[model samples]
Target: MTSEVSRRDFLKASAAGAGFVLTFRIAGGATSAAEAAGAWEPNTVFTIDPSGIITVHITKAEMGQGVGTALAQIVAEELEADWRDIRIDYPTSDPKYGLMLTGGSWSVNWTFDALSRAGAGARHLLIEAAAKHMNEPASECIAEGNRVRHLPSGKFLTYGDIVSKGLITATLSDEELKKIQLKKPAEYKVIGKWIQRLDVPEKTNGRAKFGIDRFLPGMVYAKVIYPPTRTGSKVVSVDDSEARKVKGYISTVREGDIVAVVAENYLAAVAAQGKMRVTWDKGPHANVTTDSITQDYWNKAKNDTSAPSWVDVGDADGALAKSMKTHEAAFWTDYVGHAPLEPMNCVARYQDGTFDFFSGSQFQTRAMGDLSKLFGVKPEQIRVHQQYLGGGFGRRLEPDVMLEAGLIAKAVGKPVKLIRSREDDIARDFYRSCTLQVLKGGIDSSGAVIAWKNTLVCAYPGERYGGLDKQGRDQFSLNGSDHYYDIPNQFVRAIRAETGMEVGYVRAVAPNYTFFAVETFVD
Candidate 1:
């Protein structure tokens, strides 16, 4: 769906800054304005204060990817602002931003054009404001060095000088913004030039705050006791008598299969959690293991015909049958965990039908919706304060930790900071799916690659979030199997195996394994 920032929401004077604010409400994938519009107070992409310091507010998660630096460069280049005057800031989750996420290598691809437009739009207004103050025609003025200079007179006004003189704020329509001229590649001064990363000094100097660095006043620590399997588990009983003997043990909370121990401090919580005795009815997946899941993938690849062909051209079976040189092999990839350095953690406070979440998240829009559904409140009632992530690697995209913190806080009637131990983090991870791929190829007598056939099987991760098409194929699982080579006879198919476990999108997701199989088979 396409959406543009409304004039009222796009540009205005910030109540606090007393300067112009510019915002761009660009399209973010399938999300539309109607589906995910949240409170838009001071919703802006960047702000130019009376001092002319440009603060760029980024919506994407910063998981050591340097995305903030890259995005700021895009804006600085188009705005013709001095690099020294630009600042980077990460804003909290707001639906007005639309589909706040940071994955799929989409940070730059999705925001480049829109951010450039935003920068150019602001530049146009600043130039006009400067020309008005200088009593010069806008056409003869050029923006450079964070100032507007009149060519003939050589008289210039700094952006700060123009703003301090009470510059008028104006809104640019989507059409007007599109008509503004953007700098050609040859004219780029800030984008390709070397600059110190804005986040480095803080990170290296121990001033940066990751989710794990959060410390809330009057908050307690909590730890969850995990189930043995991925699904179908229920907590039958909890004996916390011994846990109560711990110096600061508060209590035990059970919600469905999740059992958590709370205490005044993190060490006490861990100590008390170990003392408590809990029993779980490990459900249908009690016997499921990696070996069993891998075997199921192999079985499905060998026998399942209900799968749909992702690519089919010519007669691959006949070509392979007639070739004198043929090769066949199978490749397997086991389930892999995210294992981010910080583990999974969140600080959640639920009181009077409102919830506040403090954590790093790759998918804030969806997580807010999930929290709203769980708490039976409007989306506006939830606020997610974005924080730096030690590392995401596609693991923080899931909101399980945030949801768990919310559950514990609501049950305990106080703010809770939930921290998963390294063991629990790996054990309860939404792992990358196990996959098996069988490939066959034939070569002509002249050693020309002639035929190709491939079949892949896995429990579709997309099934967990409706990521599959009508044919029941997840493109995330079968990305590189469709070879780019012009093989006259080729076929590629995907089979869905029922392994009774959930899967998640890992870094590089399917291509990580798909390319490996295809490249090895080719070699």
Candidate 2:
């Protein structure tokens, strides 16, 4: 995972060979002679073939967010490539693609400039190639509709003709890439305009490949009997005699806390799963309930003074004591689940110390690394293929299902497609943290609020999911509490309480709850 190639390393390794194929060096480089040959396929991101087709490798997962379309628009706007000729595909798990994550509403915001620069750089190279063919300056040529046109004489050359004729050979350096001029917002032909979504056609035609739709050549179907609780739950025993009576039942896999029933097909797998009897130790969380969580968070919000202060300004205690009026309020929100349209599913194949996975993952790069450690193999030994997500809603960000599929595939010695039923998905999901907020405010004689204090108590999403900020705090649980008001004295803090329940980033994360409390108090 630490072997990620830097920008300089990528530029140095990339070479434009004859026949118009651009070879990009990834983690292990080219493994075969065909790849090493001048076939000219770009490694992971965007690439132009000799035929002038612009293939864009989208790193973000398309979870009904139009990310694929928005990203393509950004690239096409600067690349000046024909929209009709543009195609979109997902990249494999490789560090060369950068942080292959697609949540927190960051896909377009993070990639806007980088993708634009990449397009502009590619356009610059194409124009440079056309300049040599026309014997004109690169500045005098304009790229339009996949063709470079000399403005003086109106002579044009297609990108394919120039590239195939060996006119484009130079690749941009990191400095040159930085220096490339990007188009202003007013000049964006694709970004601001309404273009049809790339995924719409496939979805309309029923040809889209969701995680559940994944099928491998020798793949079997698997279904698990999950414990009541995610943590501190262990399988005590399993009786599969009844499952063995099923016609298509293949085998039962028991690894750690996971108990899976494998069959020749999905129906048989579900049927066999229904017949299997399993016993489990419910552990400490067996007694935990929703009401108990509510009471625990409320208590922490009122009394937890040891909580870290996320924001503080002046002395709120002195200001509130001297104020003529004071207001106090508390707000709470129950835990919720990201009930995406499609249930969790992953297809995995393990063989010869290598693993291949197919699923809709928001964090494929992280998944590859985690799976490598879980399987005790190198990062390169795992290949994660992306698929269209029916809906992520921040749920697909975790790769628990992918790991389960890999483990089952390894146990059965065959490709296995593990699918979670609706009930299983809902019951086992990493839920949004139930929150409790306490706010205290002070107002002067003029009714101008001079001081504010807020305390939040909730499960730490980062602690549960391992994405803590540099301050060693789960910012996800404290967002939106910091107000923009001109209060002279303000204090904001969060108490990380253990609810004995799993928590993760839902669509808006902590902002949803924090903003609700702040806005309600202001009104």
RMSD of each: 6.8, 5.0
Q: Candidate 1 residues 1-523, lDDT tens each?
A: 0112222321221112212224543322213332133211112567666577887878888999898999899888888889889888887777666657677787787677778887887778778878888899999999997889999999999877765665544556768877877889898888888888899999999999999989888899998877777778888888899999999999899887778999999999999989988888887888888777777777788888878999899999999998879999999888889999998999999878888899999877668776787767888787889999988988887888988999999999899999999998988888887788999999999998889999987666654343467787877777888869879999998887766666788988345888889989888
CA deviation > 4 Å runs, candidate 2? 1-44, 464-472
Can you list the residue pairs that collide in candidate 1? none
Please, what is the TM-score per model?
0.90, 0.91
Model 1, position 237: C-alpha lDDT score: 86
Model 1 ranges off by over 4 Å: 1-43, 464-466
Q: In TM-score terms, which candidate is top?
A: 2
lDDT of 2 by residue, 17-133 (tens): 110122333212434342343222323447666677777878889989889989888888888989998989886776556567677776776667667777887788789878987
lDDT of each model, Cα atoms only?
0.79, 0.80
